[model samples]
Target chain A: MNEVADLMVVLMAMTNLILLGTARLTLGVRLVGAQGALAGAYMFAANAEHPTVHVLALSALIIVAKGLVFPKVLLRTLEKAEARHEMEPYVPYSASILLGMVMLASSVWVSSRLPIAGLTIPPSAVPISIWTMFTGLFLVVARRAALTQVFGYLVLENGIYVFGAAIAGEMPFLVEMGALLDVFVAVFVMGVAVFHISREFEHMDTDRLSVLRD
Target chain B: MTMYEYSCLPVVFGLTLAPFFLGIINRTKAKVAGRQGQPLLQAYFDLWKLLHKGAVYSRTTTGIFILGPVVGLAAIVAVLGLTPFAGCPPLFSFIGDLILFAGLLGVMRFATMIAALDTGSSFEGMGASREAWFSSLAEPVLWLSFAVLARLTGQFSLGAIQSEIGSALWAASAPELALTALSLFAVFLAENARIPVDDPNTHLELTMIHEVMVLDHSGPDFAFIQYAAALKHWVLASLLAGVIAPVHTGHAWIDITAALLTMAGIAVATGLVESVMARLRLTRVPQLLVGAGALGVMAFIVDIMR
Candidate 1:
């Protein structure tokens, strides 16, 4: 169980780096979907020893919503927006990957310093969750496209879910469902906003939106 | 006495079989393109032909031009002595030898770059510059991957680290080893001027990185450069093969055979990569190299946390 969890964590980290490096928005959306699926699998793997109905249901929900449904929503938004790539990001893809590494190292350092009490979580769980969150936040700040930022939001939500899973072991069923519902609604709203923004501005370059204030 | 004699096998294997792996790569590429490939001994035959041909030098050439192939080959041979094969110790091993390994590679590049510069040709100089830039990005990843291995095994020397890896270490940290193997593979590709970094077979000088620099050398000098390249490829591939297939059988013969087979597999893998993907644009090359470095850093951090 621990080995499986560790492998999934490493895979999640790879996806995070790939997300940082990739320029194609569609590919990025698919990668985020795959990452969400991996996160759900990770949740299942981490809790494999004592599989409860609530945990199984939540994992399925996560996989279905984030992995399948969210990407479909994002892809639709992407199609409507017609933004093929995240050109001229605030940070270059290579630099973003390097920054991702820095964030990973810092997360590891921070996780190492934090004292976990009496939890038998997989050792890499905390650090990877933190790294995922950092990658999400960085994506949001660094990328230019509103759709990609929404991808960032979904990634951020995945990180939060993983962190919760890692720390709390068996989160309450109601809370997990509620969190999932919240993210679903949030993504729907973001998708609509991106649609309207791209419709109004004729481009998805969020940086150019500053012109409206003048 | 027998153990002492057995330690020299890696060097012997590398010297004799280095070009064979190149042949394997060419053949794999050929086969992939739906054509009957050159014989597996084509590289050896090319080396033989180049060796017998007469040398030619321009009146403008300097002594450094002649010294390039000699020093590059010599540096690679020295590095090969320090590299282990399939958990078998090398001809030489010492504390902090990984630094020496990396430094020797740098020396090889420096020798080649200066030699290229000595040609007084703008094309070679451009090649040399690109080589230096890409390698600078690649070197840190190499060091970081080595750091992960050292941390995992608590051994600094290449031989010690190779010998320490077994089923036990893989069971403990497969992810780290996988990441290290990946980055090392990238370094191997970049250093060898393989596809996706630089196309070794490209005729257009403008696009060439490593091949363009060697344009002036011909006959025996070119042969030496070619053989040196084969050996360098073997050395880097051996490092990757060590990580991917650290087959630590108790018997020396089994280990050597496994290592040889692994090298062939890697050659085939490289060929498939070349066949499948075009060489990246010059601007995109650094991104790939940097991504490899990022993998190395991620591996190191993950191993540290573990």
Candidate 2:
């Protein structure tokens, strides 16, 4: 269980960094979906035996919602809008990757201090998950295109799922489902937002995303 | 009364006092600028006036226009339930209550922005965009700042942090807290249509974002939306005060006094700032918010080191 959790944590972290460093919006969305499925697997593998119905349901939902539904919608939005690549990133790929590494290390060190290990899951899950969450936020800030930011949001949601997994028993079935659906819907709505944005501006660069001023 | 009873007061106080705060701030600005302001309770009167009247609808508006203020108020009330104003009596407490507290605020902004879009006017659209942009930056600052409080005292309840932050043990660390407090003050100004970020009196549609968006709203619905905006502003201001005030575990009177004083101080500060500073150009606003994020990050690092 420990080794598998470690691998899941590492894999998710790498995917997060890759999401940051990538310029291709399509691949970024796909990778976010992959990260989601990986997280679901981690939850299932970490607590397969005691598998409460809610746990299984949540894990399955994550795989479908985060892994599948979100990415598909984002890509479709990009496809329709004719904006598929991240152009003029605020931070270059190399720097974002390096910063991501630092964030991962810091997250691990930070998570180690918390008693998540004393809970049902491995301690690494919390920090790695938090690291991924903030990295997603970083991606949102660094990337210029609205299409690419969908990936950033997915990665953040993925991190939250990982954190929730650490304290799975503490949350109720409906609450977990609600949170999951909220993320899914928020992303879905954001996809619609990208469409409207493109309609108005003819481009979806983060710089241009700034039609709102003080 | 017990702590829970004391905590209840702040929540009730929160609901009751938001409009009055707006009244007070407007009066201050008027007095300072050498004009006789409306009565301090004029906001309450405006609410009464608007509510008694009917709404005038725009041809382009949709359901979102109606939903914006309703959801905004709901979100603020939801958030107040999570915060521990006087005695840490949050209606809902959890391990990561702080996150929920901030998240609810984000949700409010999210709803209102979309609601702004529902108006279908380019002016409203522009306001929504700026609100979204500034708020995206503001939310992270909010999260990181509260996370520092969580780490510093090793507590997560919004109320507990308020109380713990009140304790004398942390009082010596003024520099970081002051910076956090100041930056949060900036966020409160930006979030509210306060001066130096937004001029409530502005009639210029081309340059105005917040005012221009609501140009078409009137009567009762406009009143609710405006009141919600005031409540939202008060929530941010009070929370920032909690960051600076020794709100935790003090005499209920002491904590409440400090908190209210902080609120008044925030209003006065807003007026002073409006008097002294000019609103940054539209593009320049993000840099100011980024500076806020920088402060939050700095404070988080400071908390982690401590």
Candidate 3:
């Protein structure tokens, strides 16, 4: 069970690196979806010894929402926004990937220093979750497309979900479901905003939005 | 005494069968393109024909132009002797042979690039510069991969590392091993001038990386370069195959056969990739190499945490 969970986390880390390196917005969306699905699988594997209705339901819900529904929403947003790739990012894709490596190392360092109290999670769970969060935030800051930023936000939420699942023993069912609902709502709102922004401005690059200030 | 004699099998196999794998690659590509490919012995025939031809040299050319192919071939042969095949020990192994392995590759590249520059041709110079830049990015990834393997197996030498990597270590850290294998595959393609990094078949000098560097060579010198390249491909493929499919049957023949098959599989995969995907833009090549390095770094960190 622990090995399965560890493998899932490592795979999620790989998806995060691929996300950092990819320029195609649609591919990035799909990779995030896959990352979300893996997080759900991680939840299931982490609690395989004693299955609970709530745990199984939450994992299935996560898989459906983040993995299936979120990518659909993001891809639709991408189509409407008329963005194919995230060109001219604040950091180049290569440098962003290297930064991602740095972020992962730091996450490992930080997790090793700060151990979770009373939690018997897989050893790789904490650092990978933290790294996922860092990669998400990095994507948000580094990419120019508003749609890509939404993918970043989705990834950030997935990281939180993973961290929650890592400590599922202590996390409340209501809290977890509420967090998912909030993310779903947030994504819907962001998609609408991105669509409107692209329609009004004729491009989805948030970097150029400051031209409206004058 | 028999064990020492048996260890020489990889060297012998590399000397004779390296070009055959290139033949496999071409045939795979041909099959995918719906054509009756050249015979499986096409590479051998080319080598033989070139070896029998007379040499040609330009009036402005110096001795270094002739020296490049010879030195590059020598370095690759030495590297092949250091490479372990299918968990079998190499003919030569030492405490820091991994460094020697990577350095010989660098030496081969340096020799080729200088020879290209010696011709005073602008086209080969461009190719050399591109090769130098991309390889500088790639070399660190190779070192990082070696670092991961060394850390995992607690060995400094390639032979010891290859021998230590069995089902047990893979069971312990499969993710790191897989990631390292992926990075090595990228290095192999990049180093060998394969598709996605480079297209070996590209005739345009403006687009060629490795081929353009050898445009000045003719006859036996070109044959040496081609043979050296085939051997280099085999050497790198052996490294990757050692990591990906380390079949330990406790029988030398079975292990050797399995390793050879794995190499053939890699060649076919390469051909398929070349057929399916166009070469990346020149500007994007560094990004691809850097992305490979990032994978290597991730593997190293993950192994450390494990």
Candidate with top TM-score is 3
Top DockQ hit: 1
lDDT of 3 by residue, B150-268 (tens): 99999999988988898998999999999999999999999999999999999999998999999999999999999999999999999999999988878778888899899999999
Better of 2 and 3 by TM-score: 3
DockQ by candidate, in order: 0.89, 0.02, 0.82
- Which lDDT tens digits does candidate 3 get at residues A52-156? 998799889989998999889988988888888776889988888888988998999998888575677887888899999999999899989888888789888
Query: Tens digit of lDDT per residue, candidate 2, span B219-249?
Result: 8768877877887877787787777655554
In TM-score terms, candidate 3 sits at 0.98
lDDT over C-alpha atoms for residue A89 of model 1: 92
Off by over 4 Å in 1: B1-4
Q: Give each model's whole-structure lDDT.
A: 0.91, 0.74, 0.90
Ranking by lDDT: 1, 3, 2
Cα displacement (angstroms), candidate 2, residue B205, comes to 1.6
Alpha carbon lDDT of residue A134, candidate 3?
A: 95
